[model samples]
Target: MSQATKTIQEINERIRKGTAVILTAEEMVDVVRAKGKSAAAREVDVVTTGTFSPMCSSGMLFNFGQEPPLIKASKVWLGNVPCHAGLAAVDAYLGCTEPSEDDPLNKVHPGRFLYGGGHVIEDLLRGKAVRLKCQAYGTDCYPRRELDKSVTLADLKSAELLNPRNCYQSYNVAVNTGSRVIYTYMGPLKPGMRNANYATAGQLSPLFNDPFLRTIGMGTKIWLGGGTGWVIGAGTQHNPKPQRNERGIPLTASGTLMLKGDMKGMSAKWVRGVSILGYGCSLSVGVGIPIPILDEEMAWFTGVSDADITMPVRDYGHDYPNGVNNVLAQPTFEELKSGEIAVNGQKVRTVPLTSYALSLEIAQELKAKIEKGEFLLTEAQDRIPSK
Candidate 1:
């Protein structure tokens, strides 16, 4: 047996009428614990989840207005970072981790990235002036060979944040078991399993709350980088078949999302550039998703707590670099959040790469918007495939 079932339309109507009962994923855990899933499903209309982490697969797509000579750009650069100009005459895409040509990469100091595409994107969005240089081979129709100009985000015809993969349901915890320290995308790892690093909001993660991809799919509305965005489709390397618990939560890296949003509506606070010592540069993005409690099962899924979310630990010094998928151990988020985790009978200090406080703020902000009728639930057009 089940409680009364609600639809996206019904939730939207309640939101519009200012009668919607919205709660953050963290809050839903307590509500479901006290009242059970069935009662919570009938009482709660929406549950908001959020995550703030560095996503290397993010980038910006820009359509720069044409110049007078109508040059067809074959090579493009924003600031010092190279941008992909294969789409159209003036359209270009800037990848987040694309290092600058003059970055002095490893020449002077190893792994110290001074600037990159991620920084350039952040500069433009912050209303700072940026230099745009293009190179083109002379043609009969378009004769201009070289062009240079200064521009800002407001000067571009269009700027869109297009991420191929983000919001990983569960990611690997990185540790170093070798002799020397190793620098990785997971940050610097000390030798002899001295420290460990992990990234995720645990129970507050968007995909973790919707573990089965039932409500989060193509055309699903989400809060991305402080702006309303959409889940375009299944992201690259979206593995939904990973090992899971009875609650459907994955124990390792699993389901991912391809997100897109307009840069004009985004905020600098949520979209920022980051430089990793001994690694490279990447973009830190904030994403939030609102789940409509359509049934009792959905409510139960959203009530999952950090104590139930587990992550696989991997040795970054050797196994991870050599493409070995060997997992050291699986630890729950509750133990990881305790500031330490036991590996090989020794207590190792643990640190989080993602910001849980900020993630909670995003969830609370999203809940407030839904309660005020500023946001509404969207019916997913298609579900992401499992295979």
Candidate 2:
């Protein structure tokens, strides 16, 4: 059946009989290249893609439904990381890098604590107690003004991961050549292209596999935080209008995904809190998506190689993080991952902010779940951009 005609039930049936073939995103490339897209489409039933990296645009919502003397939590701290406690009396939104009260850039660059929202989440999953401290404006109805206590994951009535952005379609390679150390979300880059850091799953990423979001849109099935999740929307900076190459793949930064899932069901393995030297806190997340084979075109897209995907390597020493990002080198993920690349005729060391090995594991794990009729794929409820 064509992509327009294929149904979830039909693909699941094929998987049940062991006649349908499943391939990791890395393996799909060879299968499609050798057998051709048409042959690969008919033979491969699903392709599992994965990415494991620090996601800055991720956060969580915590609701303490059963707390005494309900107070409007004005300011909240969890595991020494301050949370956005302005939501309600008992609710808080803790982003991975929500700066502490004393984190003044002018005073102390890349300040201390080094842990924030993400660490709290991880510790909670590990069954460690989180120190919950908050101050509330005294109110007539909910009179409690302040609270200092320790709570566990079980203490929360509802904990959900509501990430506004995650899984960037692709990102720039970062380096510093301005004679000063540059601290960035990617990682710290030493001066003179001493180190280069890049983040992405390359070929084994969901949005990369489906550049146009043909089969992956709103409500797409995803492996989030070790459990099932759904694509809530297109991410914050999703640039559908980004410049693309001959293959229609973005040449610069592009799309991202909004994910939603229950926090209680998540595992510490798939979700982690990271401290990027001088860059503050971040959540090291593992995400996997299974693409259902419906047409030759779909198979072709899934097989797009790392060489086909391109990104700019930028000098991060300058200000205006996304702006004024001059291209230092244009390298494919293949070249970046080779442990070194030429920069001004000097071979520079390359470091990965995310774990490629973990990404492969996530993809393989998701594939096994689907092949065994454990994981389910959901059709998009609406287009991500609604365009």
Which one is best on TM-score?
1
Q: Per-residue lDDT for 1-387 in model 1, tens only?
A: 245499899999999999999999999999999999989999999999999999999999999888788888999999878999998888999999988878876568866887888888889879998899999987888788998999999999999999999999899999999999998899999999999999999989998898998889999999999999999999999996988898889878999999999998988899988888889999999999999999999999999999989999999999998999998988999999999998878789999999999999999999999988899889999999753
Off by over 4 Å in 2: 1-5, 16-19, 99-113, 319-322
lDDT of each structure? Answer: 0.92, 0.82
Deviation in Å, model 1, residue 283 alpha carbon: 0.3
Q: For candidate 1, what is the TM-score? A: 0.98
Q: Count the backbone clashes (under 3 Å) in each candidate.
A: 0, 1
**TM-scores of the models, in the given order?**
0.98, 0.93
lDDT of model 1, residue 234: 97
**How would you encode candidate 2's per-residue C-alpha lDDT over 1-387 as one tens digit per residue?**
245435667887877776667899999999988999988887888899999999999888888763667688788887767888777678888887775554444246545435567787888988899778888887887788888889899888888888888888888888887888877777778998899888888999777888878778888889998988888889998888777777667877888889989888889999998877776778888889888877887888899888888888877887436578577777888888889888778888989887889999999999898878788677888786512
Q: Model 2, residue 87: what's the lDDT?
A: 79
